[model samples]
Target: MQLLIVTAHPETQSFNFAMRERAATVAARVGAGLSFSDLYQQGFAPTPGRADFQDFPATQSFDLAQAQKAHQQHGGFALDIQAEQEKLEQADAVILQFPLWWGGYPAVLKGWIERVLSYGFAYGRDKTLPAKKVLLAVTTGGIADEQDAQRSQARLQAMADDVFGYMGWRILGLHLVHGPADLDAEQRAEALNSYAERLRLWLSEAVPLAA
Candidate 1:
């Protein structure tokens, strides 16, 4: 499988990065192609601006929709967005690993979705890049109860419809690690090992991207 892991966290040595590393290791062990983006390290912009689009109309008010449409016709976006688009287009499945910030995505990850998953490139009436297979691996400081798990799935499902087409993005799994900071070294190691094992299984079971 061709896999892309999008990770967002400020600290380079955080447990979130550990989880990402474990995931990457598993993918390599399984002989699956791997790609990843560390959004924070990239200094990613969470908000879109005039600079994000090329050949877009010059107006006092910048309309993102118009700029995105222009790019589809003209065949270009900013270098960063273009790079992400290229990786996403080639992936068979996506694994998003991030800490839940305020019960949702970190600001940078939210921005990554908005800018990278642009109109006409990720979605539109005429053309859409649909990711049919997906997985979410989330870490949280607070303890995650059953309700937390349900809510996370609901949120992901909504994103699936909005971005990946109606019920198109099938979540192969959700790996939620609760209170990683409280865990001992052995516990953390066990979590990473378990994650790697589960990830290997999920990749094997993952459905291929739609043709």
Candidate 2:
């Protein structure tokens, strides 16, 4: 199975990076092929423009294929939507890992979803991907209790339903680890163990790779 992990954190040694590493490592151990795109590290450009709405060889009626072609033909990532769609197609499971900033995902990650989950690609009348398949988010927030359903989970899940599920990608999971950086040594170890366990369960149930 192919699992794509998307991380949007600036610090290489941050807890977000560690969670990403742990996720990739366990997924690999469980026999799934692991691939990742570190947005900040890759220098992903998070901007939308007019060319993103172009219609030359094809009409501008929500054609992801055309948008992708236009992006490559024009330049690198004229829109974040096209870039992420390419990644979304290549993976059986997608993990969006980022720190919750200001009650939501970092601006870059949000921009990625806003621009990449386009009309025809992520959602439209005849979109091809399966429902809840993409596995919308893997995120961390400093505040623990506040990340609950009453606080932000419902809103976030609704957004996921609208964006990824609407696009026909089953949300295989939504793992939110708390206090990634604020944890002490013991807490860090416990956090890692918890994350590893959850990830292991996910792979065992969903991924079909050789042991």
Candidate 3:
């Protein structure tokens, strides 16, 4: 099985990165072919624009869908975006690991999605990429209370239904690790261990997507 882990944490020692490392270990244990994209380390561009295309005319108004379709047909995607698309095409499962920045994905990851998953690629095509499993492994500082937790859950569910679901990917799981900033060392370690076990179980099982 091919597995791709895309991590969008700037700090190497951050809790999110630790979780990503745990995921890497689990992928290795499962004997899956693995690939990784450390966006921060690679200095990935978070803004999508004309640079993404090589064949589009400079004077043409940037219509994202039109430009993407044209560029894809002509092999005009920038090197980075093309490489990422290639990786996605080969993956059976994709793990997105990032810290919740201001209640959403980090900008780098958001950009990666916007740029790499282009029209005629991840969507707008007859096939809509390929059927695969997606796991969102997110780390958050803390949720203030039950209301905050509910809000977060709603937002994540919307993403699962609207964003990934619309693109034809299956939502395998949404794993949220909370209180990473406030937790003590032992508590944090325990949380990581628990998450790792959950990941292991998920990897070992063949659970179907929810309707």
Clashes of each: 0, 12, 0
TM-score for candidate 2: 0.78
Error of 3 at 130 (Å): 1.0
Query: Model-by-model lDDT, in order?
Result: 0.80, 0.68, 0.84
lDDT of 3 by residue, 65-139 (tens): 788887776687988998898899999899999887787888999999889988888888553478778899888
lDDT of 2: 0.68
Instruction: Point to the candidate with the largest TM-score.
Output: 3
State the lDDT of candidate 2 residue by residue for 1-211, as single tens digits. 7788989999989887888888888888888887778889877766644445544344346455556545444545444445566667777788788877777778888767766665545566655443435554445455546546355667667766766766667776676666566779899888888888888887777765455
Q: After superposition, how far is residue 119 of candidate 2 from its true place, in Å?
A: 2.0
lDDT of 3 at 177: 84
TM-score each candidate: 0.87, 0.78, 0.93
> What are the C-alpha RMSDs, in order, of all predicted structures?
3.6, 4.6, 3.5
Model 1 lDDT per residue over 21-110, tens place: 988887877777989899999998889877787655576587887778778778768888889988998898888889888867899998
